[model samples]
Structures are given as C-alpha cells and as structure tokens.
Target: MRKSAAPFLLALALPLAALAQAPVQYSLAFPNAVHHEARITVVFAEVPAAGPLQVRMARSSPGRYALHEFAKNVYDVQATDSKGQPLTVTRPDSYGWDVSGHDGTVRFTYTLFGDRTDGTYAGIDQRHAHLNMPATLAYARGLEQRPAEVKFELPTDWQVATQLRPDANGTYYAPHLQYLMDSPTSLGAQQRRTWQTLGRTIEMSVLHEGTAAELDAYVEQSKKVVQEAAAIFGGLPEYDFGRYTFVANYLPQTSSDGMEHRNSTSLTSNRPLRGAGALDNLGTVAHEFFHSWNVERIRPRDLEPFDFERANMSNSLWFAEGFTQYYGELLLRRAGIYTDEQYCQEALNGLVGAMLNSPGAARFSPVQMSQQAPFVDAAAAIDPNNRGNTYLSYYYIGGANALALDLELRQNHKTTLDAYMRAVWQQHGQTQRTYAPANPYTLTDLQRILGEVSKDTAFAGRFFRQHLLGHELPKFDQLLAPAGLLVRRAKAGQASLVARLSFNPADSTATVGSTLVGSPLYQAGLDREDVVRKIDGQRLTSAKALPELLAAHKPGDVLTVEYRTRGGIRTAPVTLAEDPTLEVVTYETARRPVTRAMKKFRAEWLSGKAKSFYPKPQPEDKDVSG
Candidate 1:
C-alpha cells in the first residue's frame, strides 16, 4: 500500500479539539472588489480516512427562516491536498460536493459572487464587504460542531467588524460552525465606538457613505435606545460574552434589511444614518437588539438546532417573530423615537396591515402562516401566485395577536405583557441562554406561561386555539376601547369590487396580482396575472385610472370588466362591492370625551415614564473599551 499523503487524519476524525488546536481553518480574501467576488479557502488539517469529505452551502441562514439556496452564488470550486495538489471532487448535489483522493489534509478553494448587501446576503464592492456568514462561507458535512478559526485578508484601509471573539494573536476564532454561522462580518472603513453598562460592553461599528458626525450621533442615540429597552425585560440578559456588537452598513448600494445574530446584528439601509430619516433606522436597531434576549435565547424548540441543509419551518413563529414585531415598535415609543400619537398610529397600521391579508387570515391561522416561512420569508417572487390572496405574514397576524393579548392582560389581569416577557426571560433567558441551546419552549409551553401570568388557563387556551391555531381574528374594537381607542373606517363601508384584486403599478397594463378566494374580485373572473383589455367601454392601458373611477361607485353598482385570460381577451360584468380599510379613532369629542380612566390606561400602557424597573448600571462600568 502507498504511504499516506498527509498526517493527522485520526485527530480530525476524533471529537472536537480545543480552540487553540482546532484542525479546521478558513481564510477569506477580497483582492478584486471590482469583479464583485471574494476568494475563500477552507483547510482541514486532519481528515477522516474511512469516508469521503463533503462540503456544503447553507440552505437557510439562522434568523432568516426561508430557504436562500446560498450555493447558487458559489462557483469555480476545486479541491486540493495539503501540498496544493489537485484532488478528485465529485458532485453530490446542488448544495454539496464529495471529495476523495485527498491527503490527510484536504482544502477547498472557491470563488463566490456576492454583490447584494442586506442582513442575510453577501455584498462586496470597492466600498465595503457586507457578508452574512451563511452566505459567505461553506462548511464540512460533519464538522458543524468542530472548532475552527477564520482569517480575513482585507484591504489596507478596511477594518474587520465581527462578533467572533479574537485571540491575542489577532485571529478570530469560532468554537463551532453554528457559532460562526450566527456571526456576520463587515469589512471596510468602519467608524467604531464603545460604551459600558451594567458590567456589559457594547461596541457599535458603522460603515456608511456619509460624514463621520452622522455615525457618531446615531451611535449616541443607539446607546439611549439600549438603556430604555433594558426596562422591557427588567434588564439585559447576562452579557457573559464580555461584549456585544452592533454592525451597521448604511451605504447607498445596500438593500434595506435587518437581521439579529448571536452577539451582534447586521442592519443595512439605503438612507445614511445622518439624514432626517435616521430616526426610522433606529427602529431596526431597537428591534434587533431586543432579539438578544427574546428569540435568540428564549428560542422556539422547533428552531433550536437550525437546519443548514433544508428549509426549517416552525409553527411557533407567531410568537417568535410576531411578538418581536409588536415590541419592536413599542420599544421605539418607549425610547422617545415616536410621540404618543405616532405610537398609536403605528398600532393602527399594524391592525390594518394584518387585515389587508385578510383573505389569507381567513383561511389560515397565525401558526399556519408562521409555518409558511419557507414559501414567504425572504422568498423570491417567481411568477404570479396566490401568496397575496392567502399569505398573511406572521409579523402582522402575530403582532395583532400581541396587541389583543397585551390589552387583555392589562384590563383583566391587572398585568402587562411586560410582566409576561420578564417571567419568560427569568425562566428561559437570563444567564446567557443563547450560547447553549437548551430548555427551548414549545407552543404549549408559551401558552402555559401566558395562562400562569393571566391566572386563567381558559383564556390562554382560547387565545391559542382561536387566534393562533385557528383563523378567527381578535376583537380589536373591544380590545382598544379600554385604552380610549376604537376602530374607524378610513373609506366608505360599501362593498369593494377589487379590494382583493392587487396590481403591479409599473405601467400596470391591467394585470391582476391575486384574487382572494371569496372576494367579488375572484368571482368577477379576474384571476391572478389576468390583464384587463376593456372595462365599461374604456380601453384600459394602465391600472391607475380604474381606482379613481371605482371610488365614485358603491355596492350593488354593476360594471363590466373585460380582461385577457390565458386563452384570450374575455368580458364579464362585476358588481361593485365594499371599501376595505381599518383605522383606529381615539375618543376625542366633548360628548364622547376621552375618559379619565382611558387616559390613565393609555398613559400607563403607552406614554408614562416607566418606573425604574431595572438596576442601575454598575459603578465599575464607568470605563468602556473595545
């Protein structure tokens, strides 16, 4: 038999080594940003002899519950031995490859095209490199739990900002691939700042296409948001990681998105942090930072060990994502980003936005919608489909549910959702529960917590069955009344002809987006993607003119909608129907005055200065360093 080509095969096949002696290593270099590509190399210092080595691209990222097929961006892949000699690599599947004839050490060299910037995608240009870990790197099949090290050979002016802790020698290390996957790295001319609170450290790094003063101001206000947000969960989770980072990329080329991570977040936007639009950007900061406790730690059991090879669908995202959406804006209000009226407007928007997807809500429950993440969450739009007609986002449905539950808890239980969240925190979060995934909660577990907090198991069960697991919407009118708010119609209550018939506005050409199952739009023979050739003797060239003409009509008004089907142009008469709109009106008139009780309730629930519910930051936290 020929002697082995490389040594240390047994060591890699064994259990994970100490970080200092990790057998897996990665090096990334961005040499030619003009080409919009990065060269990535992975070296396995040791290899299993009995089996072929498999390398794979993640099917989905951590926070993004949707399938992104990150492999689609990977190409020019090749394998080599420890001495850089070529190895035989075979295609296993679209997302994976099998390598054989490798020395004890096998290395993979590939070029990845990444020119989109967001929290969940990879974007690289002469300006900067915004990378989501899953989108930028690949991993060995069985080395997900193996210790590894990552090195970035960046441009001279570029500084690397990532959540991965660095060793004394300046090399970033990951205890495992899972930890690595949760850490995103942005390499560019970043302005970095640091602050300390309650013995925990916060490091903010911003890479923007604006003046440095703007970034400085954004960081200053972000520190305040962090302070006010701590009150929601009583205090921050045990920041045993020693530090947390907030990585922001607000370049003109970056797509607007925000993704929560283990110790940091990837927040990108088209607007600079210095503009008048900066306040809106702060909401993304507040939202992702809160996830440091809620979803990241008090995670759904179904999503405990996130799948990297297939679409991971969870049924409890109604709470995981929806409750987070509810609190994201609520915390913004508490942080003074929104006025009393603005906050109420946001709540009203949430209610209406959810109901607009009513055709979907009418068929599926919040839980069902959450499970539809694979199809909707960050899902690419293919040809026209029924998503609009039957695909309400859990963000809306779940937020609406949260609004209802919060009011119920306040009115009936004399408790608030704040108490419930804190209780959940004490039980599931606190003490750095994010690192070691254990004691994850299920849908039933969440209901139990709610029942205990409300002191009514019946109410919790009913809420889950009807509002979460069933299609019944909450009674928003009753829920908002105690808080001096009630639903109002922004438009006439007359029936609508196409409230469910959506359109694409780019020179619309009478195209239909979706027709809800039972809407008059669906009954009018206007199917998805059908184009209207004429309606009531008018040659419809665009979608703009019909809405104005329809506004003058009401229910029982008969009209003809001539459109093109798959076969050819067709004509059908449609009866005008109701105007669908949801708005919340405050009790303001002198006759129906905003009552003292309602004012008190609203103040306590929305505007009043919250009592100091958390301990002050420690005295030793006077100095901050990064």
Candidate 2:
C-alpha cells in the first residue's frame, strides 16, 4: 500500500495542509483620537515567503464630486512580519505603498493625519469632530478586489458605523477585496438614532454640539426621509441593514453641503433647523441616500476597477449625478414634504438661475463637463462662459434636462421615469449586471428595457440621444404645458418687481444687462450703465424697480430720475411707453386635466422605484472591491 501511494494524493494533501495551517484572518484597526488624526492597521494571515504588497486609497470617494488625493494623509507607515521583524516598504506613488522581503503573517500600520482643505481628509474644526471613511482608509492595491476582514478600534466612547458586512464578532467582512476598499468607516462622538420601515431597520447617527432636542428633531426628520425614500424604492435593500449616519459638524466656517457614503453621509452646515422645515432636511437626505443606488452600486464603467492613483473620468455622470439631482427634490414632493407649488418653485429657480448666469445655455454637454470636472478647481470661481463654452455640470444643466425628460416621458407614454428606473432595477439591480458585462446592458439593452415598460422605443431613443447625449437643452415649457404648469416671466401683477443689474465690460459699477428689448426702462431712456441714484421718491439701490415703477403708470406716464453717469450726479425726465407684450406665461387650465399617461408619469416620476433594477447589490459571497 505504501509503494502504491499516488503522487496526486500527496499533492492534494500538501495543499490542504497549507490551507489549514493558514492563520485565521483577524481585523483592521482604525484609531480615532484627535478629530483630524487617525491610524489604520491591517493584520492578516502570515505568508511563508516574502511577496510584494501594495496599498492604496481611492482617488475619489463615491459621494464627493472632486478628485481627492486620499493617499496624501498616510504617513509613518510600517510593516512587520509574523516573527515581529520589520519589512522593507516604499511608496510607489502618492496613493500607494510597495513592500518587499519575506513574510509569514504581516501587519501594516500607518498614521493618517486628515487635516486639510484641499486634500482627502475633511475636518469641521468648530464641532471638534471629523468624518473619515473610504477616503482615509487604504487597501492592498491589487488586492482591493479580493475578500478581506476588518475590525475597528475607536475612542472608547465614540460610536463607529459603516455599510461593510459585519461578522458575528463585530469584525467587518468584505465578501471580496473590492468591497472592503470601497466601503468607508465613520468614527466620532456622534448621537445615533435607529428606526424601522418596510421590514428593514435603519439608523441615523449625528455628530453635533447642538442640544438633544435639536438632535432629536434631526433624527425624526431623517426617519421620515428613510420611510418616504424606501416606499418609493419598493423596499429597503437589506432586511437588517446598518443605520444611516449623519455626521453634522457645526463648524461656523463650514458651508452648506454633505457627502454621501454607502451606509452613511456627512453633512456640513451652520443653518438652524427651526425655519429650515422638513422639506429641507428631506431633500438633503434623499439626495445622499439615492446615491447608494446610483453612484455607489450601479457605477460608471470607468469607476469600476477604480484607479486609486488618479482621477477616473466617465461621460455617464449625467445619469449618475444629474438624474439623482433631479429626483432629490421630486422625491421630496412625492413624499409630501413639499407642496406642488414649492416643487415647481425649486425647479423654476434652478432653471432660471442657470439661464440668467450665462449665455452658454445651449453650448456645453453634460458628458464633457463630467469628464473635465477634475480640472475645474474652484466652484465659486467657475466662469459661466467657460462652463457654457466647454463644460456644464450635470448637477445644474443636466439636472434641468433630466426634469424635462421625465416630463416628456410621461407625456409620451402612460409610464413614467419611475417605471423606467424600476425596470432598470429589475434588469440590473436584481441581476447584479454591469452596463457592459460579458453579458452587458448596451444601448440596445436600455432601449429594450424602456420598450418593455413603456412600449415606446422611439420615444426613449429620441429622448436619450436628443437631450441626454446631445448638447441641446429641451424646451422645458413644452413638456410642462400639458400638466397645467406654465413657464412664464413673473409679472408685476402676479409677483413683486425685482430688478437685477448687470455689470459692464469695465467691471466697475453695476449696469443694465438687458432691458427686455421693449421694456419700460428701454422707453424711459434708461441706457446701460446709467447708474441711477434715485427713482421718484425712493433712492435706487438697484435698477430692478425701474421697470416696475414705469409699468405702474399709463402709456403717457412721466417719471423723474437722478443718476450718476460719466459726468456724476444728474437728473432726467422720461416718458413711459406701453409694453405690448408685458408678460408671457406658460400655465395649465382646468379644461385640460392631466392625461392618464401624464398622471401615471407623474406618479412614477415622483417615486424613485424605477431606478431599483440597475446595479443590484452583489451576493453575500461576492467581494465589493469593484
């Protein structure tokens, strides 16, 4: 029998023995002490021989729009083999590390100081807290897509929460390497709130110095958001999912914004909750929560197999970022957080704001803007001409386009964008398929999906090409007209007069940008850069009321004005002329009720259930690194 022992048996036995001898995977230690200071340590099974090892942080986290050098935060890195011997390590790039020499079991530890305005880490100094997630966590480069385990060691009293899969022992398990790298961990002295809806338990963790009453109100609003959003999605993704954490840093210097995460979002704002109302909080929560489905799960192809070393560009951000932006407010309205009037006003504000800012309304494409966003530095300093001529943020122009598309889709078929998204969810979300997997979802796939739901391939294709892919903005008024909503100038009769002054080429004093061609101001001889000091009895802070005051009088009305021209203070008398076209409005009448298709479309559009089909969550066994 000994002489007959097979070579195959011995080979199998040897491999099995090696596998059994491998050390039980342990945990990842992330220490949070100072708000801007932290450390990460990964302890793993020992390797018998030295092998090359690399670690990296993502170039940009899922929720953050700008490209961030997350790797810059890492410092004082060290690695030790199972025998407690130091291994040689070198940084291959700004975002990654390379290790050489033999190893059995190894532990990699590094101190990460995430204190900076333009880098990976963000700190809210006034609240004395920080939110560090995937942006600050590092993965073993190529191994990012593989299965790994993590454990957190935080400040004794601090609460830690994340969307990563958690094991029985509180160790977070990444089904594969990629999931571990993509999911972020949040740690701080934040107040946590928990709720249940649609057969799922949800949590809202907040970090603020505000009183408990204020925090409780925020939590209640968060629960309503989750409930409303879940109803729209059909159901929550997991029956026992982690809580949605809101890291609120009451930093007096912070602006109004929040970044989304897989299971949590960090919001920075100084606005008091009192006058803000539920609508405001609901909108904010909806925007970030929806990202879990859009950018987080069903991501752009380029974002998959992410390049942690540099920016990854994609033309599909219009769909990911812009479409979500459109849905954010719409969902709030559908959830009854805002009335129809409020929703319309918000939409109008976005549209008018975009149009009034630049003359390049029809020039830029969403895809081009998304691809080049990494190079556009400051948000405030962005030139409308530059955005108009070269780039257009999906958040603004693209969002407007999505709104039109939603309305158009409703008018064409009885189905709405909600159903289209649901079809996407059923097809991709349930199937866990990528846009172009080996079995990809192509343009044909999209067309077929839309056809199945709406029975209108022609309409879907036309909309996608003409508005989404093409540079042209739709006539939004046309889409809304069928619904009884009018897009028109705010008239003196319906609204108060508000004059806006435009600066001349010299960039000195404010002047008239445009006078509506036949406006009363034009007839009143109010030339550009007149710089009026007073109008009738009232001193003029701006030229806004000039037209209103003129419109108040008859065709033969006379008005007196004092102004500063190139010659300083002066006076002039001007006759007001009648405006034949005083106002142009787009509104709906009771005679034409919303069509059946339009009604269905509105229901589906307001509900976000349609997007559920794409980017289905991976199976429990699959790694999330991708």
Best by TM-score: 1
Per-residue lDDT of 54 in model 1: 80
List residue ranges in candidate 1 displaced over 4 A. 1-21, 274-276, 381-383, 431-434, 493-496, 499-509, 539-544, 567-570, 589-592, 608-611, 614-626
What are the models' TM-scores? 0.91, 0.71
lDDT value for model 1 = 0.78
Deviating ranges (above 4 Å) for candidate 2? 1-35, 44-51, 64-66, 116-129, 168-170, 239-255, 277-279, 352-361, 376-385, 433-444, 491-626
Candidate 2 contains a number of clashing pairs equal to: 36
lDDT by residue (327-398, candidate 1, tens digit) is 888877776777766776765666654654378887899998999998888888766566766778888888
**Can you write out model 2's per-residue Cα lDDT over 1-626, one digit (the tens) per residue?**
23211321232334333433433243433435445565667665544354576556566654444566766677888888778889888877676677677465567777766553221254523224354455656665323223566666654666555656677987776554444444544456666666555445566655455677876676665655565555555656542244444445443444556566555565656555545733454567778777656565545555554444445566666767777888777667765666666776765557544633333445556666666656653322443232323455667766776667667667777666666766665565433421112222334555577677778777767766666556676775677666556655443222211234653334233464444333445555565556756556555443444445555566555567666667677777755543332221223322345566555544555543423532453232121111
Which one wins on lDDT?
1
Report the poorest 10 consecutive residues by lDDT, candidate 1. 1-10
| Displacement of the residue 422 alpha carbon in candidate 1, Å | 1.4
